[model samples]
Target: MDWIVPLILTVITASTPLLLSATGELITEKSGVLNLGVEGMMLIGAITGFAVTVSTGSAIIGIIAAAIAGMAIALIFAFLTLTLMANQVATGLALTIFGVGFSALVGSGFVGFAIEPLPSLHIPFISDIPVIGPILFGQDFLVYLSIFMVIASGWFLTKTRAGLILKAVGDSHESAHAIGYNVIGIRYMATLFGGAMSGLAGAYLSLVYTPMWAENMTAGRGWIALALVVFATWRPGRLLAGAYMFGCISVLQLHAQSAGINVPSQFMSMLPYLATVIVLVIISSDQTKIRLNAPACIGKAFRPAQ
Candidate 1:
Protein backbone atom coordinates (compact mmCIF):
# COMPACT_ATOMS: atom_id res chain seq x y z
CA MET A 1 0.00 0.00 0.00
CA ASP A 2 2.77 2.43 0.81
CA TRP A 3 4.45 1.66 -2.48
CA ILE A 4 1.40 2.55 -4.54
CA VAL A 5 1.84 6.30 -4.51
CA PRO A 6 5.56 6.22 -4.92
CA LEU A 7 5.35 3.73 -7.78
CA ILE A 8 2.93 5.96 -9.63
CA LEU A 9 5.16 8.97 -9.05
CA THR A 10 8.20 7.14 -10.27
CA VAL A 11 6.34 5.97 -13.33
CA ILE A 12 5.52 9.51 -14.45
CA THR A 13 9.03 10.84 -13.95
CA ALA A 14 10.63 7.82 -15.58
CA SER A 15 8.24 7.94 -18.49
CA THR A 16 8.99 11.55 -19.39
CA PRO A 17 12.12 11.06 -21.54
CA LEU A 18 10.77 7.90 -23.20
CA LEU A 19 7.42 9.54 -23.88
CA LEU A 20 9.00 12.61 -25.41
CA SER A 21 11.51 10.72 -27.57
CA ALA A 22 9.08 8.01 -28.68
CA THR A 23 6.37 10.49 -29.55
CA GLY A 24 8.75 12.50 -31.66
CA GLU A 25 9.87 9.36 -33.50
CA LEU A 26 6.22 8.37 -33.98
CA ILE A 27 5.48 11.58 -35.85
CA THR A 28 8.57 11.21 -38.02
CA GLU A 29 7.82 7.60 -38.91
CA LYS A 30 4.22 8.51 -39.60
CA SER A 31 5.49 10.94 -42.21
CA GLY A 32 6.99 7.98 -44.16
CA VAL A 33 10.69 8.43 -43.43
CA LEU A 34 12.69 6.07 -41.27
CA ASN A 35 15.33 7.98 -39.34
CA LEU A 36 17.32 5.46 -37.35
CA GLY A 37 19.67 8.04 -35.91
CA VAL A 38 17.59 8.78 -32.85
CA GLU A 39 20.36 7.47 -30.58
CA GLY A 40 22.92 9.81 -32.09
CA MET A 41 20.56 12.74 -32.14
CA MET A 42 19.72 12.29 -28.48
CA LEU A 43 23.37 11.99 -27.42
CA ILE A 44 24.26 15.15 -29.27
CA GLY A 45 21.31 16.88 -27.69
CA ALA A 46 22.27 15.79 -24.19
CA ILE A 47 25.85 17.05 -24.33
CA THR A 48 25.05 20.17 -26.32
CA GLY A 49 22.27 21.01 -23.93
CA PHE A 50 24.55 20.53 -20.93
CA ALA A 51 27.25 22.69 -22.45
CA VAL A 52 24.80 25.51 -23.14
CA THR A 53 23.25 25.35 -19.68
CA VAL A 54 26.66 25.30 -18.02
CA SER A 55 27.83 28.35 -19.91
CA THR A 56 24.68 30.46 -19.82
CA GLY A 57 23.27 29.29 -16.50
CA SER A 58 19.93 28.91 -18.23
CA ALA A 59 18.11 25.60 -18.58
CA ILE A 60 15.83 26.90 -21.31
CA ILE A 61 18.77 28.04 -23.35
CA GLY A 62 20.41 24.68 -22.85
CA ILE A 63 17.27 22.91 -24.06
CA ILE A 64 17.15 25.15 -27.08
CA ALA A 65 20.76 24.35 -27.88
CA ALA A 66 20.00 20.66 -27.58
CA ALA A 67 17.10 20.95 -29.99
CA ILE A 68 19.31 22.80 -32.43
CA ALA A 69 21.98 20.15 -32.09
CA GLY A 70 19.49 17.38 -32.76
CA MET A 71 18.04 19.17 -35.76
CA ALA A 72 21.49 19.73 -37.20
CA ILE A 73 22.42 16.08 -36.88
CA ALA A 74 19.10 14.96 -38.35
CA LEU A 75 19.57 17.21 -41.33
CA ILE A 76 22.64 15.27 -42.23
CA PHE A 77 20.47 12.17 -42.44
CA ALA A 78 17.88 13.98 -44.53
CA PHE A 79 20.48 15.11 -46.96
CA LEU A 80 21.77 11.59 -47.41
CA THR A 81 18.54 9.61 -47.53
CA LEU A 82 16.12 12.11 -48.96
CA THR A 83 18.39 13.96 -51.36
CA LEU A 84 21.21 11.55 -52.03
CA MET A 85 18.93 8.50 -51.78
CA ALA A 86 21.31 6.46 -49.66
CA ASN A 87 20.39 3.40 -47.64
CA GLN A 88 18.31 4.46 -44.67
CA VAL A 89 19.67 1.83 -42.30
CA ALA A 90 23.30 2.47 -43.09
CA THR A 91 22.88 6.22 -43.04
CA GLY A 92 21.15 6.10 -39.68
CA LEU A 93 23.92 3.93 -38.24
CA ALA A 94 26.43 6.46 -39.48
CA LEU A 95 24.57 9.27 -37.75
CA THR A 96 24.62 7.36 -34.48
CA ILE A 97 28.35 6.84 -34.81
CA PHE A 98 28.88 10.50 -35.55
CA GLY A 99 26.73 11.59 -32.62
CA VAL A 100 28.60 9.31 -30.21
CA GLY A 101 32.05 10.50 -31.23
CA PHE A 102 30.92 14.11 -31.38
CA SER A 103 29.24 14.00 -27.98
CA ALA A 104 32.22 12.31 -26.33
CA LEU A 105 34.58 14.91 -27.70
CA VAL A 106 32.37 17.81 -26.68
CA GLY A 107 31.01 16.40 -23.41
CA SER A 108 34.35 15.28 -21.96
CA GLY A 109 34.88 18.67 -20.38
CA PHE A 110 31.30 19.04 -19.10
CA VAL A 111 31.02 15.54 -17.64
CA GLY A 112 30.79 16.67 -14.03
CA PHE A 113 28.81 19.88 -14.42
CA ALA A 114 25.55 20.33 -12.48
CA ILE A 115 22.41 21.66 -14.08
CA GLU A 116 19.44 23.41 -12.49
CA PRO A 117 16.22 21.70 -13.30
CA LEU A 118 13.16 23.66 -14.24
CA PRO A 119 10.90 24.34 -11.29
CA SER A 120 7.97 22.00 -10.98
CA LEU A 121 4.61 23.58 -11.77
CA HIS A 122 1.83 22.28 -9.59
CA ILE A 123 -1.75 22.43 -10.78
CA PRO A 124 -4.33 24.11 -8.59
CA PHE A 125 -7.05 22.05 -6.91
CA ILE A 126 -5.99 18.79 -8.46
CA SER A 127 -2.55 19.11 -6.91
CA ASP A 128 -3.91 18.76 -3.37
CA ILE A 129 -6.00 15.62 -3.75
CA PRO A 130 -4.20 13.36 -1.24
CA VAL A 131 -2.41 10.17 -2.29
CA ILE A 132 -2.85 10.48 -6.03
CA GLY A 133 -2.16 14.21 -5.86
CA PRO A 134 1.56 14.33 -6.50
CA ILE A 135 1.47 11.76 -9.24
CA LEU A 136 -1.30 13.55 -11.09
CA PHE A 137 -0.68 17.23 -10.46
CA GLY A 138 2.68 17.88 -8.93
CA GLN A 139 4.80 17.33 -12.03
CA ASP A 140 6.94 19.45 -14.30
CA PHE A 141 5.16 21.34 -17.07
CA LEU A 142 6.74 19.08 -19.74
CA VAL A 143 5.35 16.02 -17.96
CA TYR A 144 1.75 17.20 -18.22
CA LEU A 145 2.34 18.62 -21.65
CA SER A 146 3.52 15.17 -22.84
CA ILE A 147 0.26 13.59 -21.74
CA PHE A 148 -1.60 16.34 -23.54
CA MET A 149 0.58 15.77 -26.60
CA VAL A 150 -0.33 12.10 -26.54
CA ILE A 151 -4.02 12.93 -26.65
CA ALA A 152 -3.40 15.56 -29.25
CA SER A 153 -1.34 13.12 -31.29
CA GLY A 154 -4.18 10.61 -31.17
CA TRP A 155 -6.65 13.20 -32.36
CA PHE A 156 -4.33 14.68 -34.93
CA LEU A 157 -3.55 11.31 -36.49
CA THR A 158 -7.16 10.16 -36.61
CA LYS A 159 -9.14 13.30 -37.26
CA THR A 160 -7.15 16.20 -38.61
CA ARG A 161 -6.49 17.62 -42.10
CA ALA A 162 -2.76 18.08 -41.63
CA GLY A 163 -2.49 14.59 -40.30
CA LEU A 164 -4.31 13.29 -43.33
CA ILE A 165 -1.84 15.04 -45.58
CA LEU A 166 1.08 13.59 -43.68
CA LYS A 167 -0.49 10.17 -43.90
CA ALA A 168 -1.14 10.57 -47.57
CA VAL A 169 2.49 11.36 -48.10
CA GLY A 170 3.48 8.38 -46.05
CA ASP A 171 1.07 5.98 -47.64
CA SER A 172 2.30 6.79 -51.10
CA HIS A 173 4.69 9.63 -51.81
CA GLU A 174 4.06 9.52 -55.55
CA SER A 175 0.32 9.74 -55.09
CA ALA A 176 0.83 12.51 -52.58
CA HIS A 177 2.95 14.37 -55.12
CA ALA A 178 0.33 13.81 -57.83
CA ILE A 179 -2.18 15.34 -55.48
CA GLY A 180 0.13 18.37 -55.05
CA TYR A 181 1.93 17.75 -51.78
CA ASN A 182 5.67 18.25 -51.64
CA VAL A 183 6.98 14.94 -50.32
CA ILE A 184 10.53 16.05 -49.68
CA GLY A 185 9.51 19.21 -47.91
CA ILE A 186 7.05 17.43 -45.65
CA ARG A 187 9.62 14.78 -44.77
CA TYR A 188 12.25 17.44 -44.07
CA MET A 189 9.85 19.12 -41.66
CA ALA A 190 9.06 15.83 -40.03
CA THR A 191 12.73 14.94 -39.66
CA LEU A 192 13.50 18.33 -38.20
CA PHE A 193 10.66 18.00 -35.68
CA GLY A 194 11.85 14.55 -34.68
CA GLY A 195 15.38 15.82 -34.12
CA ALA A 196 14.26 18.79 -32.05
CA MET A 197 12.02 16.69 -29.82
CA SER A 198 14.74 14.08 -29.29
CA GLY A 199 17.11 16.84 -28.23
CA LEU A 200 14.62 18.25 -25.76
CA ALA A 201 14.13 14.83 -24.24
CA GLY A 202 17.90 14.46 -23.80
CA ALA A 203 18.12 17.87 -22.21
CA TYR A 204 15.28 16.92 -19.89
CA LEU A 205 17.24 13.91 -18.62
CA SER A 206 20.47 15.78 -17.90
CA LEU A 207 19.02 19.07 -16.77
CA VAL A 208 16.03 17.80 -14.82
CA TYR A 209 15.98 14.09 -14.05
CA THR A 210 19.66 13.53 -13.35
CA PRO A 211 20.65 17.21 -12.95
CA MET A 212 24.14 16.37 -14.10
CA TRP A 213 25.86 15.63 -17.37
CA ALA A 214 27.70 12.33 -17.65
CA GLU A 215 29.41 10.74 -20.63
CA ASN A 216 26.99 8.52 -22.58
CA MET A 217 24.41 9.25 -19.90
CA THR A 218 21.58 8.51 -22.27
CA ALA A 219 22.73 4.90 -22.19
CA GLY A 220 20.39 3.31 -24.71
CA ARG A 221 17.08 5.03 -24.11
CA GLY A 222 17.06 6.35 -27.64
CA TRP A 223 17.17 2.82 -29.01
CA ILE A 224 14.37 1.88 -26.62
CA ALA A 225 12.28 4.76 -27.86
CA LEU A 226 12.75 3.46 -31.40
CA ALA A 227 11.49 0.03 -30.36
CA LEU A 228 8.62 1.66 -28.50
CA VAL A 229 7.09 2.89 -31.75
CA VAL A 230 6.86 -0.67 -32.98
CA PHE A 231 5.39 -1.83 -29.69
CA ALA A 232 2.81 0.94 -30.11
CA THR A 233 1.94 -0.11 -33.68
CA TRP A 234 2.73 3.40 -34.87
CA ARG A 235 -0.17 4.74 -32.81
CA PRO A 236 0.20 7.71 -30.46
CA GLY A 237 -1.97 6.22 -27.70
CA ARG A 238 0.11 3.06 -27.73
CA LEU A 239 3.26 5.17 -27.58
CA LEU A 240 2.13 6.48 -24.22
CA ALA A 241 1.47 2.97 -22.96
CA GLY A 242 4.83 1.65 -24.13
CA ALA A 243 6.65 4.51 -22.43
CA TYR A 244 4.85 3.90 -19.12
CA MET A 245 5.55 0.19 -19.35
CA PHE A 246 9.23 0.83 -19.96
CA GLY A 247 9.22 3.30 -17.10
CA CYS A 248 7.87 0.63 -14.78
CA ILE A 249 10.69 -1.69 -15.78
CA SER A 250 13.28 0.98 -15.06
CA VAL A 251 11.78 1.69 -11.64
CA LEU A 252 11.57 -2.00 -10.84
CA GLN A 253 15.32 -2.34 -11.39
CA LEU A 254 15.99 0.24 -8.69
CA HIS A 255 13.57 -1.49 -6.36
CA ALA A 256 15.33 -4.80 -6.94
CA GLN A 257 18.62 -3.21 -5.92
CA SER A 258 17.04 -1.65 -2.86
CA ALA A 259 15.54 -4.98 -1.80
CA GLY A 260 19.04 -6.44 -2.03
CA ILE A 261 18.10 -9.13 -4.45
CA ASN A 262 20.52 -11.93 -5.30
CA VAL A 263 21.31 -10.52 -8.72
CA PRO A 264 24.72 -8.83 -8.85
CA SER A 265 24.82 -5.03 -9.13
CA GLN A 266 26.44 -5.35 -12.55
CA PHE A 267 23.49 -7.40 -13.80
CA MET A 268 21.12 -4.85 -12.27
CA SER A 269 23.07 -2.13 -13.98
CA MET A 270 22.53 -3.92 -17.28
CA LEU A 271 18.84 -4.58 -16.62
CA PRO A 272 17.46 -1.63 -18.53
CA TYR A 273 19.51 -2.34 -21.62
CA LEU A 274 18.77 -6.02 -21.30
CA ALA A 275 15.06 -5.32 -21.11
CA THR A 276 15.35 -3.05 -24.13
CA VAL A 277 17.09 -5.76 -26.15
CA ILE A 278 14.45 -8.30 -25.22
CA VAL A 279 11.64 -5.94 -26.14
CA LEU A 280 13.21 -5.05 -29.44
CA VAL A 281 13.75 -8.71 -30.29
CA ILE A 282 10.16 -9.49 -29.40
CA ILE A 283 8.83 -6.69 -31.57
CA SER A 284 11.16 -7.50 -34.42
CA SER A 285 10.51 -11.24 -34.61
CA ASP A 286 8.28 -11.07 -37.64
CA GLN A 287 9.86 -9.24 -40.51
CA THR A 288 6.64 -9.29 -42.53
CA LYS A 289 4.58 -7.89 -39.69
CA ILE A 290 7.15 -5.22 -38.92
CA ARG A 291 7.17 -4.22 -42.57
CA LEU A 292 3.40 -3.98 -42.66
CA ASN A 293 3.33 -1.74 -39.61
CA ALA A 294 5.86 0.49 -41.30
CA PRO A 295 4.70 3.32 -43.57
CA ALA A 296 4.39 2.29 -47.20
CA CYS A 297 7.03 4.69 -48.47
CA ILE A 298 9.43 4.28 -45.57
CA GLY A 299 12.54 3.45 -47.56
CA LYS A 300 11.43 4.39 -51.06
CA ALA A 301 13.39 6.72 -53.25
CA PHE A 302 11.66 9.98 -54.00
CA ARG A 303 12.18 11.31 -57.48
CA PRO A 304 10.25 14.54 -57.88
CA ALA A 305 10.66 14.49 -61.62
CA GLN A 306 9.30 10.98 -61.94
Candidate 2:
Protein backbone atom coordinates (compact mmCIF):
# COMPACT_ATOMS: atom_id res chain seq x y z
CA MET A 1 0.00 0.00 0.00
CA ASP A 2 2.75 2.47 0.88
CA TRP A 3 4.78 1.85 -2.25
CA ILE A 4 2.03 1.48 -4.81
CA VAL A 5 1.68 5.13 -5.80
CA PRO A 6 5.39 5.90 -5.91
CA LEU A 7 5.86 2.78 -8.00
CA ILE A 8 3.29 3.81 -10.56
CA LEU A 9 4.71 7.30 -10.90
CA THR A 10 8.23 5.97 -11.13
CA VAL A 11 7.23 3.65 -13.93
CA ILE A 12 5.53 6.44 -15.89
CA THR A 13 8.42 8.79 -15.25
CA ALA A 14 10.99 6.20 -16.23
CA SER A 15 9.11 5.59 -19.45
CA THR A 16 9.18 9.28 -20.40
CA PRO A 17 12.74 9.16 -21.68
CA LEU A 18 12.00 6.22 -23.96
CA LEU A 19 8.64 7.61 -24.97
CA LEU A 20 10.01 10.95 -26.17
CA SER A 21 13.05 9.51 -27.89
CA ALA A 22 11.13 6.68 -29.56
CA THR A 23 8.39 8.97 -30.80
CA GLY A 24 10.91 11.33 -32.35
CA GLU A 25 13.03 8.50 -33.74
CA LEU A 26 9.92 6.91 -35.17
CA ILE A 27 9.45 10.03 -37.24
CA THR A 28 13.10 10.00 -38.23
CA GLU A 29 12.95 6.32 -39.16
CA LYS A 30 9.74 6.90 -41.01
CA SER A 31 11.71 9.41 -43.06
CA GLY A 32 14.10 6.57 -43.98
CA VAL A 33 16.97 7.58 -41.66
CA LEU A 34 18.21 5.46 -38.81
CA ASN A 35 19.96 7.58 -36.17
CA LEU A 36 22.18 5.80 -33.73
CA GLY A 37 23.47 8.97 -32.10
CA VAL A 38 20.52 9.31 -29.79
CA GLU A 39 22.71 8.33 -26.85
CA GLY A 40 25.31 10.92 -27.62
CA MET A 41 22.65 13.49 -28.33
CA MET A 42 21.03 12.72 -25.01
CA LEU A 43 24.27 12.96 -23.04
CA ILE A 44 25.15 16.28 -24.51
CA GLY A 45 21.67 17.47 -23.74
CA ALA A 46 21.87 16.23 -20.16
CA ILE A 47 25.11 18.03 -19.51
CA THR A 48 24.10 21.20 -21.27
CA GLY A 49 20.70 21.30 -19.62
CA PHE A 50 22.12 20.66 -16.17
CA ALA A 51 24.74 23.34 -16.54
CA VAL A 52 22.27 25.84 -17.93
CA THR A 53 19.67 25.22 -15.25
CA VAL A 54 22.20 25.32 -12.45
CA SER A 55 23.60 28.58 -13.69
CA THR A 56 20.38 30.41 -14.48
CA GLY A 57 17.94 28.71 -12.13
CA SER A 58 15.57 28.52 -15.05
CA ALA A 59 14.28 25.18 -16.18
CA ILE A 60 13.11 26.61 -19.47
CA ILE A 61 16.60 27.64 -20.46
CA GLY A 62 17.91 24.29 -19.41
CA ILE A 63 15.39 22.44 -21.54
CA ILE A 64 16.17 24.73 -24.46
CA ALA A 65 19.85 24.04 -24.08
CA ALA A 66 19.12 20.34 -23.99
CA ALA A 67 17.17 20.57 -27.23
CA ILE A 68 19.89 22.61 -28.91
CA ALA A 69 22.60 20.28 -27.73
CA GLY A 70 20.73 17.26 -29.07
CA MET A 71 20.10 18.98 -32.40
CA ALA A 72 23.76 19.87 -32.63
CA ILE A 73 24.88 16.27 -32.19
CA ALA A 74 22.19 15.16 -34.59
CA LEU A 75 23.51 17.50 -37.25
CA ILE A 76 26.73 15.53 -37.22
CA PHE A 77 24.74 12.37 -37.84
CA ALA A 78 22.83 14.03 -40.63
CA PHE A 79 26.05 15.13 -42.28
CA LEU A 80 27.40 11.61 -42.21
CA THR A 81 24.24 9.68 -43.03
CA LEU A 82 22.44 12.02 -45.41
CA THR A 83 25.18 14.12 -46.99
CA LEU A 84 28.19 11.77 -47.02
CA MET A 85 26.14 8.60 -47.31
CA ALA A 86 28.00 7.00 -44.43
CA ASN A 87 26.75 3.77 -42.91
CA GLN A 88 24.07 4.44 -40.31
CA VAL A 89 25.32 1.69 -38.02
CA ALA A 90 28.88 3.00 -38.00
CA THR A 91 27.72 6.54 -37.45
CA GLY A 92 25.40 5.49 -34.65
CA LEU A 93 28.18 3.54 -32.94
CA ALA A 94 30.46 6.53 -33.16
CA LEU A 95 27.74 8.69 -31.70
CA THR A 96 27.41 6.39 -28.71
CA ILE A 97 31.15 6.37 -28.18
CA PHE A 98 31.31 10.11 -28.44
CA GLY A 99 28.45 10.60 -26.02
CA VAL A 100 29.97 8.29 -23.43
CA GLY A 101 33.40 9.87 -23.52
CA PHE A 102 32.21 13.42 -23.96
CA SER A 103 29.67 13.16 -21.20
CA ALA A 104 32.29 11.78 -18.83
CA LEU A 105 34.70 14.57 -19.65
CA VAL A 106 32.20 17.41 -19.51
CA GLY A 107 30.32 16.14 -16.50
CA SER A 108 33.41 15.41 -14.45
CA GLY A 109 33.08 18.73 -12.69
CA PHE A 110 29.35 18.30 -12.18
CA VAL A 111 29.38 14.93 -10.49
CA GLY A 112 27.55 16.10 -7.38
CA PHE A 113 26.18 19.51 -8.24
CA ALA A 114 22.49 19.98 -7.47
CA ILE A 115 19.66 22.30 -8.47
CA GLU A 116 15.99 22.87 -7.70
CA PRO A 117 13.75 20.98 -10.08
CA LEU A 118 10.97 22.59 -12.04
CA PRO A 119 7.83 23.17 -10.00
CA SER A 120 4.82 20.91 -10.36
CA LEU A 121 1.32 22.21 -11.00
CA HIS A 122 -1.60 20.16 -9.78
CA ILE A 123 -5.31 20.26 -10.40
CA PRO A 124 -7.35 21.03 -7.24
CA PHE A 125 -9.33 17.87 -6.59
CA ILE A 126 -6.95 15.47 -8.34
CA SER A 127 -3.97 16.69 -6.33
CA ASP A 128 -5.75 15.86 -3.07
CA ILE A 129 -6.57 12.22 -3.85
CA PRO A 130 -4.78 9.88 -1.44
CA VAL A 131 -1.64 8.17 -2.78
CA ILE A 132 -2.43 8.49 -6.47
CA GLY A 133 -2.98 12.24 -6.16
CA PRO A 134 0.52 13.40 -5.33
CA ILE A 135 2.20 10.79 -7.50
CA LEU A 136 0.21 11.28 -10.68
CA PHE A 137 -1.59 14.61 -10.67
CA GLY A 138 1.15 16.55 -8.88
CA GLN A 139 3.87 15.76 -11.44
CA ASP A 140 5.89 18.45 -13.21
CA PHE A 141 4.76 19.89 -16.53
CA LEU A 142 7.25 17.88 -18.57
CA VAL A 143 5.37 14.69 -17.71
CA TYR A 144 2.20 16.16 -19.19
CA LEU A 145 4.19 17.51 -22.12
CA SER A 146 5.40 13.98 -22.83
CA ILE A 147 1.81 12.90 -23.25
CA PHE A 148 1.07 15.86 -25.51
CA MET A 149 4.10 15.15 -27.67
CA VAL A 150 2.82 11.63 -28.30
CA ILE A 151 -0.52 12.94 -29.43
CA ALA A 152 0.98 15.65 -31.62
CA SER A 153 3.37 13.24 -33.25
CA GLY A 154 0.58 10.81 -33.99
CA TRP A 155 -1.70 13.38 -35.58
CA PHE A 156 1.06 14.96 -37.61
CA LEU A 157 2.18 11.69 -39.13
CA THR A 158 -1.21 10.23 -40.00
CA LYS A 159 -3.19 13.29 -40.96
CA THR A 160 -1.08 15.77 -42.85
CA ARG A 161 0.45 16.33 -46.32
CA ALA A 162 3.90 16.72 -44.85
CA GLY A 163 3.40 13.41 -43.16
CA LEU A 164 2.49 11.75 -46.46
CA ILE A 165 5.54 13.25 -48.13
CA LEU A 166 7.80 12.08 -45.30
CA LYS A 167 6.34 8.60 -45.67
CA ALA A 168 7.02 8.63 -49.40
CA VAL A 169 10.58 9.72 -48.80
CA GLY A 170 11.05 6.92 -46.30
CA ASP A 171 9.37 4.33 -48.49
CA SER A 172 11.15 5.30 -51.70
CA HIS A 173 13.67 8.06 -52.17
CA GLU A 174 13.35 7.84 -55.91
CA SER A 175 9.62 8.39 -55.78
CA ALA A 176 10.04 11.29 -53.38
CA HIS A 177 12.66 12.83 -55.61
CA ALA A 178 10.51 12.26 -58.67
CA ILE A 179 7.81 14.36 -57.11
CA GLY A 180 10.16 17.13 -55.90
CA TYR A 181 10.20 16.24 -52.23
CA ASN A 182 13.58 16.95 -50.70
CA VAL A 183 14.62 13.65 -49.22
CA ILE A 184 17.78 14.93 -47.59
CA GLY A 185 15.98 17.92 -46.17
CA ILE A 186 13.20 15.83 -44.75
CA ARG A 187 15.61 13.35 -43.24
CA TYR A 188 17.74 16.08 -41.70
CA MET A 189 14.76 17.80 -40.11
CA ALA A 190 13.23 14.57 -38.91
CA THR A 191 16.52 13.44 -37.43
CA LEU A 192 16.94 16.80 -35.72
CA PHE A 193 13.56 16.46 -34.02
CA GLY A 194 14.54 12.98 -32.88
CA GLY A 195 17.75 14.30 -31.40
CA ALA A 196 15.88 17.10 -29.65
CA MET A 197 13.50 14.65 -28.05
CA SER A 198 16.40 12.46 -27.03
CA GLY A 199 18.01 15.48 -25.43
CA LEU A 200 14.88 16.36 -23.52
CA ALA A 201 14.72 12.80 -22.30
CA GLY A 202 18.29 13.04 -21.03
CA ALA A 203 17.61 16.33 -19.30
CA TYR A 204 14.84 14.64 -17.42
CA LEU A 205 17.37 12.19 -16.01
CA SER A 206 19.69 14.79 -14.51
CA LEU A 207 17.17 17.52 -13.79
CA VAL A 208 14.30 15.44 -12.50
CA TYR A 209 15.05 11.77 -11.81
CA THR A 210 18.51 11.75 -10.29
CA PRO A 211 19.32 15.45 -10.10
CA MET A 212 22.91 14.50 -10.75
CA TRP A 213 25.15 13.25 -13.52
CA ALA A 214 27.58 10.36 -13.91
CA GLU A 215 29.41 8.96 -16.88
CA ASN A 216 27.09 7.33 -19.39
CA MET A 217 24.15 7.94 -17.08
CA THR A 218 21.75 7.35 -19.93
CA ALA A 219 22.98 3.72 -19.70
CA GLY A 220 21.48 2.43 -22.95
CA ARG A 221 18.15 4.24 -22.87
CA GLY A 222 18.92 5.22 -26.45
CA TRP A 223 19.04 1.57 -27.43
CA ILE A 224 15.81 0.78 -25.62
CA ALA A 225 14.15 3.65 -27.42
CA LEU A 226 15.36 2.26 -30.74
CA ALA A 227 13.94 -1.18 -30.09
CA LEU A 228 10.67 0.40 -29.03
CA VAL A 229 10.20 1.78 -32.53
CA VAL A 230 10.16 -1.72 -33.99
CA PHE A 231 8.00 -3.02 -31.16
CA ALA A 232 5.50 -0.27 -31.86
CA THR A 233 5.43 -1.26 -35.53
CA TRP A 234 6.15 2.38 -36.43
CA ARG A 235 2.93 3.51 -34.80
CA PRO A 236 2.72 6.29 -32.17
CA GLY A 237 -0.12 4.79 -30.16
CA ARG A 238 1.67 1.48 -30.00
CA LEU A 239 4.95 3.16 -29.06
CA LEU A 240 3.22 4.71 -26.04
CA ALA A 241 2.14 1.27 -24.93
CA GLY A 242 5.59 -0.19 -25.46
CA ALA A 243 7.27 2.67 -23.61
CA TYR A 244 5.03 2.30 -20.58
CA MET A 245 5.29 -1.48 -20.70
CA PHE A 246 9.06 -1.36 -20.73
CA GLY A 247 9.06 1.32 -18.07
CA CYS A 248 6.90 -0.77 -15.78
CA ILE A 249 9.22 -3.75 -16.08
CA SER A 250 12.18 -1.53 -15.32
CA VAL A 251 10.55 0.04 -12.27
CA LEU A 252 9.24 -3.26 -10.92
CA GLN A 253 12.70 -4.74 -10.91
CA LEU A 254 13.92 -1.94 -8.67
CA HIS A 255 10.85 -2.17 -6.53
CA ALA A 256 11.51 -5.86 -6.09
CA GLN A 257 14.95 -5.00 -4.78
CA SER A 258 13.53 -2.28 -2.48
CA ALA A 259 11.08 -4.83 -1.08
CA GLY A 260 13.96 -7.16 -0.26
CA ILE A 261 12.89 -9.87 -2.68
CA ASN A 262 16.26 -11.69 -2.22
CA VAL A 263 17.26 -11.30 -5.87
CA PRO A 264 20.62 -9.78 -6.74
CA SER A 265 20.32 -6.19 -7.80
CA GLN A 266 22.38 -6.79 -10.91
CA PHE A 267 20.08 -9.55 -12.04
CA MET A 268 17.06 -7.41 -11.38
CA SER A 269 18.73 -4.60 -13.28
CA MET A 270 19.08 -6.87 -16.27
CA LEU A 271 15.44 -7.87 -16.38
CA PRO A 272 14.21 -4.95 -18.45
CA TYR A 273 16.87 -5.45 -21.11
CA LEU A 274 16.34 -9.19 -21.13
CA ALA A 275 12.65 -8.57 -21.56
CA THR A 276 13.36 -6.25 -24.48
CA VAL A 277 15.25 -8.99 -26.32
CA ILE A 278 12.57 -11.59 -25.63
CA VAL A 279 9.81 -9.26 -26.79
CA LEU A 280 11.68 -8.33 -29.95
CA VAL A 281 12.29 -11.99 -30.74
CA ILE A 282 8.64 -12.76 -30.32
CA ILE A 283 7.50 -9.79 -32.40
CA SER A 284 9.94 -10.38 -35.20
CA SER A 285 9.67 -14.15 -35.15
CA ASP A 286 6.75 -14.08 -37.51
CA GLN A 287 8.05 -13.19 -40.96
CA THR A 288 4.80 -11.82 -42.23
CA LYS A 289 4.43 -9.50 -39.25
CA ILE A 290 8.02 -8.29 -39.46
CA ARG A 291 7.61 -7.54 -43.14
CA LEU A 292 4.40 -5.73 -42.45
CA ASN A 293 6.00 -3.60 -39.74
CA ALA A 294 9.50 -2.57 -40.83
CA PRO A 295 10.18 0.72 -42.52
CA ALA A 296 10.38 0.13 -46.26
CA CYS A 297 13.78 1.77 -46.60
CA ILE A 298 14.86 1.97 -42.96
CA GLY A 299 18.57 1.95 -43.61
CA LYS A 300 18.62 2.93 -47.28
CA ALA A 301 20.50 6.02 -48.44
CA PHE A 302 18.87 8.71 -50.49
CA ARG A 303 20.76 10.44 -53.30
CA PRO A 304 18.86 13.08 -55.18
CA ALA A 305 19.63 13.74 -58.85
CA GLN A 306 21.59 16.82 -59.89
Q: Which candidate's TM-score is highest?
A: 2
lDDT of 2 by residue, 1-306 (tens): 877787888887898888888888999999988987787888888898898898888988999899888888999999999999999989988988888888889898888888897788779998989987897689888788888898888898889999888888888889888988888999999999998998999898888877778788888888889889889888899999999999999888878866779988899999888988998888778878767756689888877778
**Number of colliding residue pairs in each model:** 0, 0
Q: After superposition, how far is residue 144 of candidate 2 from its true place, in Å?
A: 1.2
TM-scores for all predictions: 0.92, 0.96
Q: List the residue pairs that clash in candidate 2.
A: none
The lDDT for every candidate, in the order shown, is: 0.84, 0.87
- Which 10-residue window of candidate 2 scores lowest in summed lDDT? 286-295
**Candidate 1 Cα lDDT to native:** 0.84
- Candidate 2's C-alpha runs over 4 A off are none
- Deviation in angstroms for 231 in model 1? 0.8
